[model samples]
Target: MKVKPWLSHLKPYPPGKTLEEILKESGSLTTIYKLNSNENPLGPSPKVIEALRKSLSEIHLYPEASYLTLRKALSEKWEVFPEEVILGNGSNEVIEFLFKAYLFEGDEIIVSEPSFLMYTKFAEIYGVNIKRVSLTGELCHDLEGILKALSPKTKMIFLDHPHNPTGQCLKRKDWEAFFQRLPKEVLVVMDEAYGEFIEDEEVPLGIEFIKKGYPVMVVRTFSKFYGLAGLRLGYGLGRKEIIQELEKVRQPFNVNLLAVKAGLSVLSDLEYQKKTRELVLTGRKFLTKALSELGFKVYPSEANFIMGDFGKRVDQIYEALLSAGIFVRPLKAYGFPTSLRITIGIEEANAKLIEVIKRTISG
Candidate 1:
């Protein structure tokens, strides 16, 4: 049997190890602190749990193919027409929708060197050409370099705001400058997976650009801030025509029944949202300060995770933490071998991580 020749070169995504995997590997540690995936430390909202319980009886029925209820809720929340919204199993599926709708073999797309692995992964799967621009001196996307890399065949640009791993974000003015210079033919896919964690007022949300009628698609997910990673729900907002085209590529009922219920329930849970935000903000500050004081270079982050450079001790520090039943992300794949991306866990988890790091480094 023959497969697409590209499959020979494709590499699978390297995900963080699960607690069960860690336990099996170590065999001695019974407790685990997983600070790797940048997940919400507060877990799911109680309202979401209640909604899921009620929804269990509906498992026998298929979810509505259009997912109108959840779409309308998101539309009202974001003040967009329901027709402009596109739901996905995860925002990643929405991304695949873009590729399915627009990209063809030999077409080009631009992305930052270390932005999101999925962008490159998808490009490889689709046989689309990828132009990877290196980040700027400050570890932010190099907009000028990206613009220079664009060609007539370039169809899209995938940029992750509050960029993954490092959590650096571009300012409104910086985005404005890039948009002004961007060719109208090229579409910009703003991956705002961490949008809810952004604390800086100067950082512009992608919806602001969509409102101004920019050829932009803002892909977001419930996985991060909404604590719905297990549910696999996300959506995209764009022009009605673009969304309609993308929707045509979507499979019927891609989102599951319980995920739809959980998404709707969380949308109305204001108290849960507030608590999650506060916890992330407080934890981010504490981790940043604590890590910096330990003689490490802590990058400024507006997202729920902080990336710190431990210099020569990165491998030793990571191994020590794992042995102590703590797991943080090592950034070698993102080109930062000496850095680690630590999710802002709850107060206790953050403190425990700090204590372990202090001991590991001192010894």
Candidate 2:
């Protein structure tokens, strides 16, 4: 049997430890405060839960292939036309759609080094030539470095604003500058998975750039702020022409019935949206201050997670916390040997995490 040469060296995305798996490993703890995956600490929204229950009866029916209702809800919410929307199983699928529609083998794409592994993973799967530019010293996307690295063959740029792992955000002026110099043919893919949690007023959202007529595609998910990670509902917003091309490559019925219903319902649940946002924003501040007070270097974050450099004690503290039923993301895989990415939890959970770190470090 012949295998694609590009796939031979590829590794599957490493799975995060599930509660069951973690319990088995610990052999003791019953409660797990899961913060490793950046999921909403609140779990599914109450409105979403009710919507899903109502949607259960429709599971036997196939979802609408175009997902027009949800698309319209998103378009109204974002102020874009319905034709500018394309739904995906997850935001990750939208990334794949971009590859399927535009990128071909040997075409070039630029990504910040260690931004999101999935970008490079998809590049490798499709045999595209990936150019990874180094992030700035402040751990933000190096817009300058990216511009210098561009070539005629470049097709897209994938940047996770409120960058993953580090949780740093670049200013609005910087983004505006990038678009001014970027080539018209190259589309900028803003993977704003955590966009809802941004607290900084100076940072710009991808949607704003779209209104300004810049070449950009914004990928968003229900997973992060909406407490809908399990639903796998995500969408991309772009110009109608770009959306049409992406639609051509998208799988039929890519989003499920329940996700569509919940998505539509959640959009109308303005109170629930407000509650979730407040929870993330407040928790983000408390965690950052507490982590910093503990003598760790906490990076400024517009996202819900806090990235802290625990110095040489990182590995030791990570294992200790895991044993104590507290799970946080170790960043060694992302090349931060002395840091961890911690999702902001509810008040008690956040307090517990900080307390554990304080105790582990002091003794």
Candidate 3:
């Protein structure tokens, strides 16, 4: 059997190495620290853990196909109707659904170059042409460039808010301007995976645009601040019609029962969410300050991670950190060879990282 032509040239997506794999690869488990993936250093919430334990015995059963309970809980939290919500194995699935439901062969999707790799990956997988617009000098979405690139064949515009690796955002006014010039049939997806960490009021939430009758979807994940990446639960909010369209592509029982129950528990755990937010904010400040003082170009961030350009010494620093069992992400895959994206860890992990970098640079 012959595979699709598009599948031949496409490279597989790279996942961050797991702790176990890191230990095996490095030959040492003792001193290892993982800041590579932007996962919560604090781990999952206690309430979620309790909920998961309660759900353990029910693993034999398939989850409710509609995931109604989780949707209802999210609806109450976001003040939207349950019909407007769609659950996914992760927000990534929701993204895939958009393409599956709306895109025909030869259709195009516009996305910021080096924003989220998955948009490009998904486009490639689904045999859609991707019109890549470069990020502005500030590393945020170039709304004007994207708007200019839109065509009748464009099905969607994928934007990652508080954008990945760069930690920059598109302001509300910029979006308003872009939307005014956008084609009415084109869908805009705001991937707000990092929304909980945003400190800027000027950046528009995707939900706000959707409520105002814009053809948009706000894709959110419990992975970041809710600390549930392992459970792989995420969702989208949009017009009820848009959600219904996605539902047609969704697999029955896509979201497992444990994740649904855990998500429900964590959605109401405001105190836990607050703690995770505050921790990331504080750690971001400390690390940004330290890195800037050391003369690295630390970009202004409103997320749980910081991106810094270390000039040509980035490779040396990265290797040194690896030797010391500290794993942070290098942005070579994102076409940023001299830059690093580091997840904000606990206070001790943050301090240890600073110490390691200091020694690496000085030595």
Give the 10-residue window scoring lowest on summed lDDT in candidate 2.
Answer: 14-23
Best by lDDT: 1
Residues 96-192 of candidate 2 have per-residue lDDT tens digits of 9999999999999999988888999999999999999998888889999999999999999999987998889998999998899999899999999
Runs off by more than 4 Å, candidate 2: none
lDDT of 3 by residue, 1-363 (tens): 999988898888888889888999788447777898889888888998988898899999998887888899889888999999999998999998988898888999999998889998888998899999998887878998998898889989999998998887778888998888888899999999999999889977888899888888999998888888988999999999989999999999899898898899988888898899889999999999999999999988888899999998999899988888889999999999999999999998889889989998999
TM-score of every model versus the real structure: 0.98, 0.98, 0.97
Ordering by TM-score: 1, 2, 3
In angstroms, the error of model 1 at 109 is 0.2
In model 2, how large is the Cα lDDT of residue 255?
Answer: 89
**Per-model lDDT:** 0.92, 0.89, 0.90
lDDT-better candidate, 1 vs 2: 1
**lDDT (tens digit, per residue) of candidate 1 on 25-96:** 877787778889988888899999999999998899999888899999999999999999999998899999
